[model samples]
Target chain A: MSRHVIGVLVENQPGVLNRVSGLFSRRGFNIDSISVGVTERSDVSRMTLTLDGDEKVLEQLTKHLNKLPDVIKVTHLDAGCVERGLALVKVDVSSPESRSEVMQVADVFRGAVIDVSRDTVTVEVTGTEDKIQAMLDLLREHGIKEVARTGVAAMARGPKYTGTE
Target chain B: MRNGCDVVLESFDAEGVDTVFGYPGGAIINLYDTLYDADLNHVLTRHEQAAAHAADGYARATGEVGVCLSTSGPGATNLVTGIATAHMDSVPILAVTGQVPTGMIGNDAFQEADVTGITMPITKHNYLVQDADELPGVMREAFFLANTGRPGPVVVDLPKDVQTAETDVEYPSVDDVKRGIRGYSPTYGGHPRQVKRAAEAISGADRPVVYAGGGVIASGASRELRRLAEITGAPVTTTLMGLGAFDERDPLSLGMLGMHGTKAANYAVTESDLLIAVGARFDDRVTGKLDAFAPNATVIHIDVDPAEISKNVEAHVPIVGDAGDVLGELNSTLEEMAVRDGSEWREKVKRWKREYPLDYEESDDVIKPQSVVEAINQHSPEDTVIATEVGQCQMWAAQFFDYTKPRSLVSSGGLGTMGYGFPAAIGAQVGRPGATVWDVAGDGSLQMNIQELATVALNDIPVKVAILNNGYLGMVRQWQELFFGERYSSTDLDQVPDFARVAESYGVKGVTVERPSEVEDAVREALEHDGPVVLDFRVAREENVFPMVPAGAAINEILEG
Candidate 1:
């Protein structure tokens, strides 16, 4: 029942996401979220997956994943890290007062104004899962229109590094 | 100077590796690019999971550290199950994946995923490369960790930029590499006193039985196990995971004891006066009721893993060491001591086998799994390599197949991973091409990696696949029928693909059998084919694997056929 977040470093290529996700599915592992993107290295990519299993299962899974030919490195991220996700929430700006209230709430969370229309305003918030939830909660009072959220992605905090393989 | 991926590969080649299996993905593209022109060769699998299993099979077959590659996100995650399988089976393998570049790592950048943190618990050791310079050392260290100690899988995660970045390469020799796992040495020979005690116990017992397991094969102690059995004149019963450790046809053999085991096998375990358990974990499936299991017996256990000692059934004498080495010492000690034959005990076991022999009804209306297995035995070569997937087929393989050579029967015994047979057969074929390799799988298990037929075709490996197509998750269905009043739920696989078409799609020849008479002909044709082939036989679905002891029931409570 121990949950874990694994930070994976890989080369950017097609079908990689499916390959990783399918693995979890086939083994009947419950994966909460998987976030992927390009990194500072244009050719490389990073993915963070949150999954839960026992110590023995985790040990076996990690070793098996490392054996893949395309994988460059797989790191099980430590909990002592600043983990975060990005989300965009669109609120119904039916009135001028509603738009102002939304702006005030976004400002409180340090969220940026991404898009706006006569009847709607989209605020992009980047922070910890709790922070994003807070912003979403505040905006929900103003009648939420739509939301798109990037799944949780994390990294170690401070000068600490997982180290390169 | 070397990038992370280049550094990893160079280190692997230095480690004397020639082959790796993987699938390319966003995060791992850079590594594949570097590997393409590198001295190391890579087998591009359709799925990352298959790559991991292939590596596992390679490791199991060759005793070499197998390697696999995948990209970030799903690519990295896909290798998890395969890695877990290898770990459970104690196979050595290395999985490498590429990660997002340093700056955009957690920005939800396209195709980025954290592999290392996800795989921590599944691997022996895992490394995430934050610096390019450490790549070579990490790869070397990964290999060392994988192959040494209690051999298992290790992981290395590399960032893309780091792989392409320049760094000085410092390759470490095999002997120079340092490993972190403690007390993991595969060769832990037991002390002399332990052997003497074990020998004395064996000699003194009136009704002794040698319970052999895969440890005998892993320790290369099959010959020693045989010698011990012959010297003591004790009949041997095996765990499901221990099949083929002793010759199945040997007169002293009691096939697969415990739950779902032969009645004679189970009875022998419970009735024996002394139980010599070797290289076995005393798994619940084997013990059934730990309290009642071998209740009348004085147990002497020998295993490589110390943790396994006294973890399940309490042992009167526990010796932790390599099964072969310790058994060898025990054999020498027995030769020196005055040990008498237990003819009465042997006769009792023989009587048990005769009284409740393993049997299955076969009529013209249905193709029973037992009949299929018997046909396989009738047709297979003397040194045939038969790999079975888990469930009914695996049990049948254990019961029916006569394995004269060690490693002749490869199956997911401990882990019981479904779809293990096909990839393992390919690996076995690669290891021993002269031996006739057959992947005998049930329909439920075969579909797990049915796509591996393409691997066979692509690699030109002529391993034959025998599908016991019972149109259901046979084992689970059988359990439901026997225990759950036959209220089948999601057990029936009515939506199975046309196996022939599926095989043809992969460019492999496919043969179908509807009658029992056609079984031999289909198998023979597949064996004769110059390339990979699949023989799908429509076996009866309701056929239960017999001689089953209900979970936690005493060994004596075996339900016979």
Candidate 2:
């Protein structure tokens, strides 16, 4: 099964998310990550959706969703399009030597130390899905206390938005 | 003399608008200015939401598209909920909203909240007039869209600039209206093969029960449903929305099913070998534990909405169509098959009804909601239209009101909005002037829109309002008592106003009933009143609607009081 990412452009309004999620829920489809935010146009908002489903079901779902009133347009982006996920990892910084070691790994991954205290250091990283996972793997050796990641907020590779006048 | 607002006002007049309900603001002031000089009358609703609902009620009662106007921003947003409610119930309403100027479209204009975008989900269709020239076409389309198809609310957002902009307006042709939309799709009904299949299933079954719902009323198929039940000798059970679809007094009627449904109704649904669900959505509230609901039954679901077919409980023989058309077809098919009454099925249903009956303790003091419903039936004309707000009173009205005719009773069946009845009653009264229209409401629900008393009085609509003032949101409190540790929270409503004074302020006669003896007189006085009247009956607050089966529980294990 090929993992696919789909970006949905919709008119931002109350119950639009509910409608989109409801479509998935009713079809018994498990969504991986969904992020909704305002687009360049104030009237419209773009929803970046990640889910696993049969290709035929996804195709049918996209058409059904377009049939809803508020849904303006939907686009299924290919792997060539650059998409990034943001993640923040907070790990224990108990040992003095490991702190530098974690910082070295963070520097390699282009991750920033967002917050630092004697017991813990919170690293913020933003990149494609694999890069974020790699940063987490390196930080895990230092015994991570907690992690909070914004669930897959995404956009297209170049100057292209699904919503237009 | 040649103002753009006048053009719009004249168009409304031509479209047959006798009355409109709305609260005017700065954006709509120009339209109101034109209305003031014109013969068109407008009722100043306290809230824009009420105006929308009032328009919805008016539409439902009259079968014409209801019209409401509100200013931009909050005024438009307030109308959203009511619009959604009307859409949910499939009532035709045309909402006119004022928006900021076309130039001030997206600059965060004051009193502007993108009403067209916000209402897209709620409305069947909406139009935002960017050009003044587009106003006539939009208005014409709004009316057509609302009144046609499944009948739902439509909105036309008139910018202040557009309302005040001078332009030559021409109404669009009907062909132009249907160009973009496929409005001619027929709602589902009986197909020949499915009707034959249903008849065969019914005849072959050992025990069969007819589970009817609100769609029966919408389809105007109550008599047909009853006929099918009688012919098959299958006892009838109704969901909360399905109450009046069956005659409550009929011997074969097992009363309401689901949570708060009668023991017999629930028992019949559970034990029946063949479950025939007509015009009913198997709501979780009705089905309880879906796996356990109608366990032994080979369900045959017949509904208008394709989505409702096999959405919840799977149907062995699914028929998506109008209830009237399908039931009529099924009857003909049954006649062809020469299907006779199954004596064993009839005997089982009768035994269930006799053993676990719809029972309520007779109290000589406090006024029972059941008694109030019955009294309304006896006092009012048979053709009188009764609209009930949600809660215990809604259930009681659905149970006790004898609706031998179609569309005689209006209710917030799908959404169950609390404050629906008062405005709906006003709309009903206006729609059917000679018919006695009564808004049967619980105190908590009535207070939500008791302000509509003013609309009633001002319009001289004279709709009788019966408030079963139990001093609590009876339905919720009933649940708390049954499910929770009986620790009633926000349900208890105390320090109520003198309702008589409230009614008097609105220039309507008010009657109060405390004792059971006063019930008859109060209802009688309310009925006889020349204008709008309020009968506030301070009935039992703690009286729970009985025969309630908690959700997910077996239908047979009902909580009877």
Candidate 3:
């Protein structure tokens, strides 16, 4: 099985997401992550879904999605597409030495310190999955207290604008 | 004033909706009022649910979109189960429900039950008209969606005011209607590469089995399916909904596959190297113990609905298109490809068919449900339409009836809803005037919508009901007896209603068959009836539908009793 990311443009309407999700679950699709947001056009919404399945399974899922009344278009995002995620992690800074080390690690990853307290430092990291994971691993040594992640949103990379056609 | 009701008439006229099965109620009085003067034929049913089912039967029988109407609240809620039944079977039906005045929506207005929300999941598309102006467009889209690609039921919830308020009734032309609805286009022709791949797989395999489903009939692909099977010389099997899609008399016919399926069909599936699934979803009942189902076969699924292609069985070569169109391409591709000799495979399938022919015990006192259905099959004219309710009777009918034509056998295959057959028979009879229609039902299921008898009688629709009155919910009873050690918990009917007498009271002909000898005569009498007729056969109460693969058991590991 291979991972496939599909970007769908659907007419902005209530319950379209539920319909899309229900279609996936009905076919036993294993969706790793799904992100939905309003696109450049307000009348249409974009849903970027990452699912793991063979070529046949992905093809069927794509067809089913297209059958939805609310769906306008579906694009199978290429493998070389750009995918990014955002994460916020809080690390305990009980010791001065640990706090200094955490700051240095955050600087190297280009992560910004969003909040600072006597016992904790909240850092915001934005990048592809690997970059986010590397930042989290570094913060772990300083007793990472909490982590929140926004699932990956993806798009095809090209010279011309890919407006979900 | 040309009101929303005029919009309804104009829309139906433009869509070529000749008949609507429905009932009049408070919320939809305006629609009923205008319907009285409209150019369409309206059959007033006893209940809203029956109307929905009748519409489904109508669609199944005629291969055209069926229409049903109901008032809001209890009326709309009543249509839910019927809508779900149509959805499951992929029957194209348009249900127009009258909601409370727009202002009263969501306020729990008397008799209102969030009709739109309740029917959302069950429908292909639904609309609660926000403006009277949108009524025409919604109706047009409802018909288009319901009859398109994976044909299914669609709902249009019109408020009382919407139907009463004056509005311009401009029925959009077909092309104009197309532009308004986006994102729901269904592919008719499959990808050429996939079709060629499927053809190659079929040609390469010696033991290939062609399994088809209801989609074959819905897409009018049965003729193409027969040609494909003939060209490949592979054995063919159908799901219950797929009956009549293939000629049962053909040597290649394996009847049906799955739970309670024929021993031959089940064995063919297990032993086959290539399984060509046409227009069929791998339903649990049809694929007992999913993991072990067709374990040896490489599946090639062709269907209009992409979701169903890989929903149950993984399709090695999946084709998402209209069944007829896909099968047509497959047939053409196979014509050019190197054809393998499937003669050996054909001989083995014939042997399996001979070894385990469908049968039942002969009783002197109680009617064998199988014998009753078989007798009907014998006495009925060619091309008789048979609608069945859920339970043992449904299985018996499926096994015994020689369905030779598409749309000849209509039943609740996917949802397995009871009380479906009787109303569906009404719809079928209404759709094809002069055609004989039979509701092969179980006592438990017949009682669910027995009220439809009044509608049948009033219309003089000559549909007949053959009730396998086993005095218990036979299917569930059989399960309880086998799996639950015969606890019989709530499975037995304390006092069975005299369904025949009930039908007589509704001004329809009624017959009761208690002795096994009377099965043939009773079926004949019912068939000859001028109006609706009900034949209540006091069948063997303890009868079981067999070749059953006990739930969760492998398809090949069946109890062939």
Candidate 4:
């Protein structure tokens, strides 16, 4: 099965997220990751969902998402789309050598050390999913404590917008 | 200035909703009180589920948005099955439910439930009116959403405070409400290119079959479907929900196609070179063993719901539009094309129909359920509304009846709810007061909502109920007997009440028919009754619906018993 990222524009109303997510679970479609936020229009919300399915599955998923009254439009963010994900990773750095190693690894990835404690260091990273995965892999050698990720947020690379008229 | 309840009534009036089916409870007392003196006709069903089913039946019969109302918590939850049934069949129904006050919504107040959360997946859309000002808009939107596009059930959960809270906001006009919903715009006309492609496919095929479904009825496309069939000389096979979409007496009609569908229809579909599916989804029941279904055919699917296209079975030419509009386009396009002569294919289908005619063994000792359906058909008018409870009785009604018009057969096709028929028949009778409405039910299915007999008796609804009393859940029993070596588990109804006596107890006319000879007379007597009547026919317990596909088997692999 191929991975697909679909961007949906929906009415910014109460329980609209529940309606969208409920449809996924009800129809037995699996969702890998989903990120939601208000768009340029305050009354509308944009949801970027990463799902694993084939062409037929993606088509079915998009059609079902469009059926929801809250959803305005659904777009498949394919080749010409820019996708990024934000992740916060806290690493165990009890020793000064380990702390410097973590700092160097974070510096190489262009990530910032957002918080530091006596035995732990939290790094804030924003990049493509692959880049974040690569940085996280390097930090894993230093004993990672926790990781919180805001799943991929995507948009078309060109001037054409998702919900634009 | 007006209260939220007044806005609700005004919205109904504006939408031309004359009837509502509901059950009263504490949370909805305010609305019920308002309905007490309103111009709207309110049908008080004995149970909330029956109310929903009746509304659904009304919607199916009249092509209008059926409305059902209920109180909070248990009352609202009771409407769940009916709502899901409507959702599955794409029936246009509006379910209005009362909620606990906004302040007590999350505190576990008495008679409180998350109505919106409960119905999220089952409804086309739903709303929890938190403010009084939102009531008018929500009511209008709920009706519009329920009735438009690929229609289904929509819920409006009104808080007690919202119902009582007053606001002077003017209720929006119908056009305004229709334009206000930005996210919901249903495609009405098929793409011209797709329609042309469909027409070309139809014209080029040597053997073609038109598979119709509930969408044809929903879009009022029966005439268009007939025109297309006549123009192309394609044999038409309908799903259970599409029973009345085309006149069954037509020479080209193949009746139904599916698990319990006719041999002729199944064979036609399996052998056809082109399958034109109009407003019908490739449901598991219809397309048994999906990979093996219509394998040789190039499918052209036209449906209002884009999601339904290529859902179960992939379509070669997918047209998204209302059934009537798409069929009209196809017919026009076909007029300009040289359609292939299908006389040889028609003769082949006719030979199949003759070779595998639907018939049941005649026994003077006991009643055959098929004969009961025939007896009803013989006595009823052409436009009679026949609703059936699920199981063998439902299949028998589908197979035996000669439906001549749309909106005549109102059976639960998608959800297959057992207790759907009686209440739905009541709703159909209410919708068409001058038509003869009959509920053909199995013993187990009829008992599920037999309580609705009180509602019918009270309202003096002249709905005739024919019970095929087999003393068991016959469909499951048939399965057990065939597939499980006669190990009849919990399928038998050991102590089914005498349905006729039960009807009599409800102050309605009742009759019990034991032998085959008594079927016609009982049906006539029931039909003659000016008010509601229940006729219980003790059908042979071991009889099973044949020409069966045995569930997962291909439709062509039918067993004729």
TM per candidate comes to 0.75, 0.77, 0.90, 0.99
Best by DockQ: 4
Global local distance difference test of model 2: 0.79
Docking class of 2: incorrect
Clashes of each: 100, 7, 1, 0
In model 1, the Cα lDDT at residue B528 comes to 72
Every candidate's lDDT: 0.79, 0.79, 0.88, 0.92
B36-101: candidate 3 lDDT, tens digit per residue? 877789999998899999999999999999999998888999999999999999999999999889
Candidate 4: lDDT over CA atoms?
0.92
TM-score of chain B of each: 0.94, 0.90, 0.98, 0.99
TM-score of candidate 4 on Cα atoms, chains taken together:
0.99
Which is better, 1 or 3, measured by lDDT?
A: 3
Winner on DockQ (1 vs 2)? 2
Higher-scoring candidate on DockQ, 1 or 3: 3
Screening candidate 2 with a backbone cut-off below 3 angstroms (N, C-alpha, C), the clashing residue pairs are: B188-B321, B188-B322, B189-B321, B189-B322, B260-B548, B288-B552, B289-B552
Off by over 4 Å in 2: A1-165, B1-17, B37-41, B147-149, B166-169, B182-192, B223-227, B230-233, B243-246, B249-252
Task: Tell me the deviation in Å of residue B97 in model 4.
Answer: 0.2
lDDT, candidate 1, A1-165, per-residue tens: 787888877657554565566566655667777899888777667888777787656665665455443456778885687788899999999966999999999999999999999999999999977799889998998999999998788888789765333
**Tens-digit lDDT string for candidate 1 (B301-357):** 998766566767778898878888899899998988877678877888899888887
For model 4, residues B1-561, the per-residue Cα lDDT tens digits are: 999889989988988899999998888999999999999999999999999999999999999999999999999999999999999999999998999999998999998989999999889999999999888888888888998899999999999889999998888777877667877889999999999999998999999999999999999999999999889999999999999899999989999999999999999999999999998999999999998899999999999999999989889999999999999999999999999999999999999999888998988998888999998989897669999999999999999999889999999989999999999999999999999999999999999999999999999999999999999999999999999999999998999998888999999888899989989988988888899999989999999998799889999998878
**Highest-scoring model, lDDT:** 4
